[model samples]
Target: MLFRFLVFLYPVIRTLGPATAALLLIAGISLIGYAVLRQPGLWSWLAAGACLLSAGLLALLCHSYHWWLFKLRPHGSLFIPIK
Candidate 1:
């Protein structure tokens, strides 16, 4: 169930850019680690792990589409050329 949700998030994250994806991945891992050490319930652990996995997949997706993600935007023109 969680895996399916993460799969769906891949394309959304890919459009967000590598830096954002990487930051999210790092934050997710940190949260999972913190939960493992402080949380007592199995559900909490599973939830944290799912978040971490999702972030990791997002990062990978972003990296795979890096070039497309950072494509140059069209520049604005000062004035329209006379036809």
Candidate 2:
């Protein structure tokens, strides 16, 4: 679910500059990880949300991805850069 939402939002985010988008994504994931560690019940909530909304949510996610970007080369501006 989280991945789907990220995919659905990434193109719009990339418009703000890919570097900014990537940094914001990294920060957001770090924050979410912290939150989950502080309150483990988040996993149960996530599971419940998944169970309740799986079908329509997945359909919307599939429809939302910007597939055309796949053809654009120089794809080496990696989102998760290697150290």
Candidate 3:
């Protein structure tokens, strides 16, 4: 459950930087591999797949929305309003 949540937030965290994102992604993959090896089951695989799919979809949606916003407003401002 927590792992899925982390996967879902993967893209968001990726905005930090490529190196950081790559490291985190590798860690996540390792964790996933460990889970699969520890408990090899059909349901576990299905759940992992589903989590990955949803996370990818979410990342796509976020990227598209960010692109749209950038297109709509070309000002040099970030999508996240930092104070």
Candidate 4:
């Protein structure tokens, strides 16, 4: 019932792709960083962790997704029929 409706909507939402998720995460981190920076006692550790997390997210979003890049030849074989 509800699951079917949500599943139908999944592709339409995913059409916007990973960049949107990365951007949203970056915005959230920015807000958190601002709040943490304002606090006097917990500034250093919170800011460091937030910065590391944001950097990791950015790195993940920007990287190539191709998993078969190491080989010189194309991954497809004649024996393996196309789906």
TM-score of each: 0.46, 0.28, 0.41, 0.36
Q: Write the per-residue lDDT of candidate 3 for residues 1-83, one digit (tens) a residue.
A: 54344445546645643444445445556557866789776765666666555556555544564454445543565444222
Inter-residue clash pairs, candidate 3: none
Clashes of each: 0, 0, 0, 0
Q: Sorted by TM-score, highest first, which candidate order results?
A: 1, 3, 4, 2
Query: What are the root-mean-square deviations of the candidates from the true structure over C-alphas?
Result: 11.4, 12.7, 9.2, 9.1
TM-score of model 3 (CA atoms): 0.41
Best by lDDT: 1
TM-score of 4: 0.36
Residue 80 of candidate 4: its Cα lDDT? 23
What local lDDT does model 1 show for residue 10?
53
lDDT, candidate 1, residue 82?
A: 23
Off by more than 4 A, model 1: 1-15, 66-83
Per residue, candidate 2 scores C-alpha lDDT tens digits across 27-57 of: 5565556557766666644654444354344
lDDT tens digits, residues 10-58, model 4? Answer: 4543454365656656665765666667744466456656665765654
Q: lDDT of candidate 2?
A: 0.48
Worst 10 residues of 1 by lDDT: 73-82
Tell me which residue pairs clash in candidate 1: none
Report residue 17 deviation for candidate 3 (angstroms). Answer: 16
